[model samples]
Target: MSRAPLLHASPDQIAAAARRVMARCDELARVTATSGRIERVYLSPEHARVNRLAAEWMRELGMRTWQDAAGNQVGRLEPAGSSRIDQRAGGHRGPALLLGSHLDTVLDAGRYDGIVGVLMALEIVRLLRMPDAASERWTSGLPFAIEIVAFSDEEGTRFGKALLGSSAVAGTWEPAWWDLTDADGTTLHRAFLEFGLDPGRIGEAARRPDEIVAYLEAHIEQGPELDRAAEPLAVVSSIASARRFQLVVEGEARHAGGTPYDMRRDALLGASEAALAVERICAAEHHIIGTVGRFEAFPGAVNVIPGEVRFSLDLRGEFDGERDRVWGSLSQELDAIMGRRGLRWRSREVHAAPAVFCAPLLQDVLRAGITQTLPSRREEPPVIFSRAGHDGMALGAIADVGMLFLRNPDGVSHHPDEAVSAGDVAHGIRALAESVLHLAAEPAR
Candidate 1:
């Protein structure tokens, strides 16, 4: 690691940068599908609008901006004296240090979850960019180029699969995803075409390993850990390994009044037991989490017994082995409960992602950045493992990934009430900017 001195941002500069980020977030919030709530999904008109706005912002900073084949809004700032003409003519293809987060959001989402990261990246670029001799071109002093990517579809709100945008960048896009449908029955392939994208050109979005130097993202913590500690920032050690499942419990449907207690086979009751088992088993393990987010029972009539029940399970853990073990235990408990209740149960895995640890070099840089920003604190900056999924999970396949988390009040996310303090956002911007400098000081890999 390089021990070079970092150029720290002044307090006033930090505050102004943070204000710009907050205002941009509010600006993007207005371009949503829902009239009142934020709900920008993949391939939606809102997505296109945000992309245009991001591209415009990137251009304002004098960057070479474009929308990738995957619909990700990208902006690149090359080192000083780099020829823009050469870049456009395919003459420059050096590895770039990538920074950004997703632009898409879940239904009725908060403003800061992914939006802050993308905006913060822009702020960092503004802080680092300098006017060349001509005063007409913008460039950086760092050895590598800086590229900001506002990923188009990390939430998967419309297609039911997360990380679609980053997966494309990481060259991990699955062909079968094209067949996936939304609530309105529009296929992903058709949606792509309708959005003015050619499905056949999707492969052009995949970036080779050598093209990217590393990936760094600054985002809201989306948890209460930092808020509870009364801290503004933390270095993320790793993102949790996660598995999602769609489970079904089946039994015989009968008339509620005619069915005797001894003769009744209640599938809902069995499913309820299974849900409890998931909670109980995961809660017993350290750093493991289980959530039953959705549940439905067949036979909507109150007078009729439900013959089948369906539920969704979202399980995650710090370690893959521990997470899988907890899932195994939960499965056993579910089997036992169903057998005793005269019901049958089955589950289909919906999504699975392994844990992604931050690169040690990047983690050290972030720590130094935080330390520089908070010199009054005697202790080292806190380190936390993210329990939520991130685009880093997909980008990890192509380059080293690191994340700096800003405190989110009450740890609320995926809802309208999710929030972050403006002061915290200011500190986060300063720390993240310093981290970029620290990384730049290091010798080229």
Candidate 2:
């Protein structure tokens, strides 16, 4: 690791750059599936459009840009001393520092959730090489190259599988996933074909563990802790362990008017009781959260008793063991609730990702960067745990990961009202740039 001298940009410059990042996010927000809101999903035309626009920006920074086999838009900046284009060559350049987040958004998505991370990375490079001649000069002085990625799918809104793009890069793509389908019943394979991607070539997207020096992600704090602290940013300690399940409850359908209250076997009623149990159980546990975000009832007519109910459970905790314990309790609660209601219940987990801890060395660099960029009074930055899952989880499979969380005043995310302040964005950009320089200076591990 080379410990390079720290770099700083004036507050004015940072503010200007921050405005640019915001403007770009606003521009990309317009490229969505819905005319009135943001809804870019994997393999959608809007996804293609956003990639084109982001690629144009990457080109402007003089980075070699390409769409990886998995549909991620990637940009590479080689070190100034190296002329090699391929990192896998026998004459391979040193492992590049990885930067980025997913570009795809959830339904009615917020503009900054993942978009800001990619733009901030671009801005970091932009700030570092502000002098046109210095771009190459700075590149040559670095020990390793830099790579920016705008991952294609992290939301899983369209295909029901999160981290598809990052998982490919992590070499964790499952062959079984090819059979997964979207709302229109379009399989991932068919979607790849329609999007001009060859499903067979997905293996080409994988990056060896040695290919990345470290992964750094700058994302908004999807929760309200930072806002309550009145801080713009903090270093992430870990990503919460998470599990998602589709729960079903079944009972006999009957005429609502004819069914006696004492003899009722209502699936919807049982599910409603189970939902409360989830909330009640999770509420008592520290740092544990459970949400029933989606719900549906069969035989929905007002005159008919619901025969079946399906609901989604998203449970998360700071630790996997704790999370699993909560799941066990919730399962028992559901079983008891079903028994009392004389209904049948079942659950199928759709997703499970363990907690990922940020690399300590990288965390130190991030902390230093924050101090150097923000000129904080404190030597150590507040380290917050992310309850929300990120592309970092997938990337963690291949490389050490670090993260910086920018404050979202209301801590609201995954909704249309999601927002961030320009000042906080400026702080985030400067901190990210500083972290890169800190990394550039470290000796090879």
Candidate 3:
């Protein structure tokens, strides 16, 4: 009957708790809102004050946190001193190991978006209650049953409902999105019963299959792949397949003093060479992507000539039949670049989703915790491809999902000077406190 072992979280104490969760997420990115296209935050009121300071930093780290009533934001961590040696090592389960992310952002986010996976799940429960690297079989035992959600709107930015609370904890929030509407039309069932909740209990916010088995997320490769491989740590493997659209071009407006540029058929000059051939065919495919973000023109005039223009593309990849053959070759190369400039087109889909792969046994425990917690930098484990998007894609529709990427040292995210480095987010939270202690103390079944 000897015990006194469970210790983990050094990498300079998860880089000083990831610089105190990036200075309390830069004081919630200088007070929340800034604009929306899935930004600033949703389910507003500064997303319930960043879900009440992520349930008060998981009850100031003694664990046992909360917020659900569909505001999500959980925070557990009870192994009761390693529950009878992880239930005699069968891994006594009761639905656990669920570290989450996404606490509303986008209009002007970035204090480590999704607030660095809720402060790396409260610094992996203060590195398993501090002993510092107990693995050759943790006897001071805490063999999994840890949690730390914080979801509540991934980035619908405000009721657009993108993975909002991982689609109500994977119940897939689709009661026709409760008569959704916005742009000041407001509706997510009258904004979740005007924020008190219970639009017929919206499927009672799912998550009950015992309570959740495994879901890890630690975002921000938000783009620029660790500043193009100056590497701060990434281990995502996948999560790409996307699609979005909206293309309208029409033509003929005349009268910038009676149109003259070659007798004008301009629709914003055929939407500038079909938005630069959809960014050169998304860099000619291979981890493909094609963005246009947004565009518009119509009689938006300083004299008028652009009858119409409207634009958008946002393609993606990592297969879904090569993201539907690069969304049908970027709509047949923007309809042959707007039919050789005759201009008259229209496309629309607005959304499509698919792609999420991580979990080769927790990416070999986050590449052996970045080679035993960062060995002077040639740590190799780099494969970034999550071109921004996740709640680990609705907890990869239940079970086996993983992600961890932190290297956005000013690369940009949603906005407000989106930065990330205080030593590359405390070295990606000491490689996510060694992937939450080797996938939450494995061996329990």
Quick one: ranking by TM-score, best first? 1, 2, 3
On TM-score, the stronger of 1 and 3 is 1
Alpha-carbon TM-score of each model against the true structure:
0.97, 0.96, 0.35
Best first by lDDT, ranked: 2, 1, 3
Task: For residues 1-445, write the lDDT of model 1, one tens digit per residue.
Answer: 5444366446787798899999989999999888999999999999999999999998788777878778898988776555544455112357888999999999999988899999999988877753232242334467777889999998888988999999998999999999999999999999999999889988888888898889999999988999999999999999999999999999999999999999999999889888888888888889999999999999867988899999999999999999999989888898899999999989999999999999999999999889888888889899999999999999999999999999999999999999988899988888888898898888878
lDDT of 2: 0.89
Candidate 1 residue runs with Cα over 4 Å from true position: 1-5, 83-92, 130-140
lDDT of predicted model 3: 0.71
* Runs with alpha carbons beyond 4 Å of true place in candidate 2: 1-5, 87-92, 133-140
Position 298, candidate 1: lDDT:
94
Give all candidates' CA lDDT scores.
0.88, 0.89, 0.71
Residues 1-445, model 2: lDDT tens digits: 3324366567788899899999999999989888888999999999899999989998788877889899999888777667646644112356888999988999888899999999999998888776673354353266787889999999998999999999999999999999999989999999999999999999888999888999999999999999998888899999999999999999989999988988789999999999999999999999999999999999799899999999999999999999999999999998899998899999999999999999998898888878876663454678999999999999999899999999997899999889999998998998888888888777778
Candidate 2 scores a C-alpha RMSD against the true structure in Å of 2.1
Positional deviation of 410 in candidate 3, in angstroms? 41
